[model samples]
Target: MSTCRTGTGPLTAAELEDWYAVPLGRADGTWVRAGLVTSLDGRAAGPDGLSGSLNRGSAGDHAVFDHLRRWADVVVVGAGTVRDEGYGPLPAVPLVVVSRSGDVPARLRRAAESGTRDGPAVVVLDGHGEDVDPGRVLTEVASRGWRRVLLEGGPQLLGTWLEADAVDELCATVRPVLVGGDGPLLVPRSTSLRAPVGSTTHLLAWEGDVLVRTRLR
Candidate 1:
């Protein structure tokens, strides 16, 4: 992780390992966390309409992002994010999908079906009729023996899961830009937590992004 040059340079592999090792905090049974990036203006993405755009010039954010992904057992995400970001196959971990119309994104669906080097592992939870049950989705992930679940979201999905109390922790990256728009917030304003939440606890800052690690109260 030496190339992460910016805020902290030449970081040791042992340091990153120790930092992200217990990132999700203490886990009673299952460890679930959402990893998303936001700008200073609180927009989750820029005009490009993708969070990946947040780390366009800086590879530092990407290095940390990839590190977190590598530590995850499975990635949980919403269908909208899959469509918007054009999700592909995850290397080793399976994807636990949450879709409304049971529509898996074309790119991911094809990768799972074709069975290429992209790796074939995609599980779209039946999110038809009503909203997808967050507990049920977590249960499915747990059933697969996935202890560390990394949730990548598109606001709405995060809000729902947060409301459901299925989320164990949140890892958000605050970028240095002020992407102004009606762009998505870290959590959609339309959805609220079951109760009022407070400020997020600061974990660490790397490069130009601020990392916040907190559990729902």
Candidate 2:
């Protein structure tokens, strides 16, 4: 996870702000970027059923996570992740829980209610029977001008989006550990991690971990 290469390397304070001040021009809908981590052997979760072990207190990775959160207008996640990760309220952004039933965790609901104007908005993909139509979700979000969307996901949800050709980009960090469970599957759209629909570009290497971005359809 050393300095392999970088399109935007040496992510300094100035670089972090405005994504190295690269002006990613606007388009028709929301720009969806996923933030995920995996082990060197490719497992999203460990024996504990969470990504914490893969991270193992990697401050650089955590900083990247925070930066993604700050960069997004809304944070979208799957319900299973909310339960397994035991999430609470976010700082100043709303959370969108993509589910067939559109049911939210009680804690998350309470957090949404007790917080500032930011809250949770439900988008039920009942038409697809638990298969979230990410396009519809992004369309809804984009209509509201929440164009910077971050999908912090459970693999299944990301897999669904990936299959639907909905993701705009994927930002990932590959840690040095190798876990045995399911091998950090980024998007299970296919049987294996295929070449990204577009291409994968290295962002930077941080704290013995590799950060990369993949442009998607």
Candidate 3:
């Protein structure tokens, strides 16, 4: 990824990977990191109401998205986002779909049922009639030894995690565009956490996309 930070040249691929890696000594608890793409006006989706649309032509954002996925030991996403984004199975990386109804995307359902080895096992984590608890999800993730967690979200899912204080880091890519109509924000308006949650750790730019890393604790 190219960095536009002053006094620095483009970052090498290894350097970029290091920037996204889990801290060296973080073995005690799960490190939950969220990845989201937003527009210049703070809208999480484009006019199309899908996050992928926000990064439509931005290679940098796409690169960072892939990097985050590769860095994750397990990927957690809400069922709605998975459906809205037309998500498929990832090769060798477990995908945990959190759903209130215990429903998952069709492709994942097929993959899970077929006992397919071509992709990572698709797991449906039901909330058992309650709001899917972020803590519960993380506990299960830790149980599986997948501590380097990545949360790809729909806004409601992200807001819930933020309210529960289950998120450790947030990796946001701000595209240089605007979608002025009503669109989702980074978090839900009803989220109880009134204050901003984290400290800015890194601000790097690549191909007009600004990547921000915020440490939540």
Question: lDDT ranking from best to worst?
Answer: 3, 1, 2
lDDT tens digits by residue: candidate 1, 1-217: 1112123433466666665556434454577778888888888887888988876765545766777788888998888888888887777778877888878877666655565536437877756856798878877877878888899897888889888877777777778889897888888887866576534543566666676666653
Q: What TM-score would you give candidate 1 relative to the actual structure? A: 0.85
Q: Which candidate is the best by TM-score?
A: 3
* True-vs-predicted CA distance for residue 177, candidate 2, Å: 1.0
Cα-based lDDT for every prediction: 0.74, 0.69, 0.80
After superposition, candidate 2 runs with Cα above 4 Å error? 1-10, 18-26, 101-103, 110-129, 189-196
Scored by lDDT, model 2 comes in at 0.69
For candidate 3, what's the RMSD? Answer: 3.5
lDDT by residue (tens digit), candidate 2, 101-207: 65667766555555533344433233335566787787778776788888998888888777777677888888878777554475563633345375654467776
Query: What lDDT does candidate 1 reach at residue 76?
Result: 86
Question: lDDT score, residue 152, model 3?
Answer: 94
- Against the true structure, what is each candidate's TM-score? 0.85, 0.80, 0.89
